[model samples]
Target: MTDPLSALEAAVQALPDDRTLRVRYAELLADAGRHGEAIEQASVVLREAPEDEAAKAVVRRAALAAAEPPGSTPAAAPPDDRHEDIDWSELEASIANPTEPPFVERVVAEHDEELVAEAGETAEDADPVAELRRETVRLADVGGLEVVKRRIDESFLQPMAHPEIAAAFGKKLRGGLLLYGPPGCGKTFLARAIAGELGAHFISVTLSDVLDRFIGESEKNIHRVFRTAREHAPAVLFFDEMDAIGAKRSGNTFSSFRNVVNQILVEMDGVDSQNDGVYVLAATNHPWEVDAALKRPGRFDRMVLVRPPDDDAREAILRVHLRRRPIEGIDLGDLVRRTKGFSGADLEHLVTTAAEKAMTESIRTGSVRPMRMDDMRAALKEVKPSIGPWVQTARNVAEYSNGSGEYDDMVEWLREEKQL
Candidate 1:
């Protein structure tokens, strides 16, 4: 049998000094899983054009392909090695240094639906060679937000599980969801839970992961994320703090951001794209800032309001936080009533504060003491629901700025809570 690769190799040798030809050859080798040869070809290009960002990318990608064992998504999404190709030093001074808030403040190991105070490594530290499947965080683990969980089951999970039935009713298997609510309200956790429900891989995209200081790279980064999800089919690609990346493009001085938004729109539902098993989920504290075009029909089409957990959820959140702790005779009912309107994070903080009180008492008595109702009340006096301020802002938006009634869910919830 004639060897096509050998012919290509001969072509590379014939024009060994042609960087463009060698680059094409490298790409073909990498795609064919001939990553070792691909790496060698890319190295040759880098030797000639050391500053070539494209060549550097070939090297990074080829090395990544070579490291993969057989067929499995790599544990950590590779860094934007394309960033290595461009020199951002000159542009750093001109680019206004917008302060980026932390993506994930901390991690805790799951202990029977409870977020035990156990610390763990981030995604970057996960095993690259190991199978990518890890335990999915189901809705049960979520500290409350029963309404949000039901919506996900009805709107998202149902569609995912019964694709044929959905298609018969004119629903496409692929789509995007935008979960918007106040900070620390378990939006990110809900997205993970949704992924878990479907038994799909979840990729949480961040502004830092997509936006680049160099030109055009932001768009490429977005493409790379989606491509990764498609390769690992039946996957959920989530974007946290999405408003920052998908902001309204109008009147934006930076065309680069506009370009990134445009890229996202195209990727979500391009005519030539096949996103069948790739579900898109995005979380944002500020959905109002997201581009109107993104919410039109195909991209981020449906928006879900993730309000603070109700009393039941508060108790659940409290139980999860106080489970392993030394807590005795704590009245959950009274605490839930007092902690009304608190988000899940607020509830966790409430428990933590109460524990701190117990520790202080122990420090004086030289003996550990179980948390008590008094400690809970003392913490409640100091720490109020953080959702109140955010809810106030949301109220105005829901009542006044809801031109299309998209914020109806949030508005209804507000009215029911008497906060409207």
Candidate 2:
């Protein structure tokens, strides 16, 4: 005789993609006065299906219920008029034509979904590590970022490739490289390419793979991750969002995460384990937010700035995305010239939007139509560069807080782009 609520919770955990199961579990949680859990479950549903009115109601009601003290009756709340002026039709259209899928979707497509489970919960018995025994994408596959590739070759790839030469030069295969850039700029892709070059196993980890609600479990998870990497020696362990996992420890709000950072530092330094052949790589949009200790010598000591694609890279990205699609009259040169500040992901969205337009026209005409330059031009109107805010933030850091000159690469990029 299992408890119904417990059984339902287990089922939802097992099949997270089942929207109906999630909604029912949320409802039961709300009924049981577990408002906080209800809100979390409902929010996960909303993230996947934004138009789920039932999940939205559960969130609103559970939130209100949580505000009341135990044994106190909740008073009827006033209506929320915050969005009364919003144009419903326009909003719906925007939702339908999303410039890009959510971050969760992008990461899940490339890595393990279990690695991105909701905060403060562990994906029980789930192996989130995605190990690529032989990576198919090499540095040659990367469209641009020649400067980044050269830096990696000099610092990491060459040494790993010619161990005898490295030994003769007294260069130990140690330390990690941090790739910082605007979101959707192919940092993860670059990391995979590095692994391909090294001809090693690739494992990408995110915050969800390490954090857990139980005390001491996070530290244990960090150890487990390193151990797995060591077992597959000649491996590349990439941490996607380093800032969240290794935030500055000075803040009281992040005191709980301090141990996690300390554990990472210990593991990176190989204090209690043999990290001889394991290569560590990390990427973050906010390098300034990462723990300063993690940037110390022999850790993520070297940082590289991966900027938006240049002309050649843009053309290559466009061709790769459109090669299999039904397209015609696509002037790659013109499209590349027009998309000056677009990141790799922005270009992908541009192509996807163009394809969607062609699909819509086909539906209306009852005949398949090839995606044309006009369709691309129309998509361009809706898809703007998503890297502006990040560039502005980088400019602020390079100008005001760069006493150590750690962000010199970013400063040089800002000047080249006339943003300084």
Question: Which candidate number would show the highest TM-score if scored against the true structure?
Answer: 2
**Clash tally for model 1:** 0
* Alpha carbon lDDT at 228, candidate 1: 73
Whole-model lDDT, candidate 1?
Answer: 0.74
| C-alpha TM-score for every candidate | 0.68, 0.71
Which portions of model 1 show Cα errors greater than 4 Å? Answer: 1-135
lDDT of 2: 0.79
Query: What are the per-residue Cα lDDT tens digits for candidate 2 across 1-420?
Result: 998899999999899899999999988988888776776687677655645877766665665566567799865433555546645444332322122321112113423344546433344323445454657789999988788788888877887898888789887765599999999989999999998988888888888787753334566668778877887878898999999888887752222366679889989885566787888999999999999999999899989988889888899999999999999899999999999999999999999999999999999999999999999999999999999999889889998999999999899999999999
The worst-scoring run of ten residues by lDDT in candidate 2 lies at 98-107
RMSD to native for every prediction?
Answer: 16.2, 12.3
Off by over 4 Å in 2: 1-132, 252-254
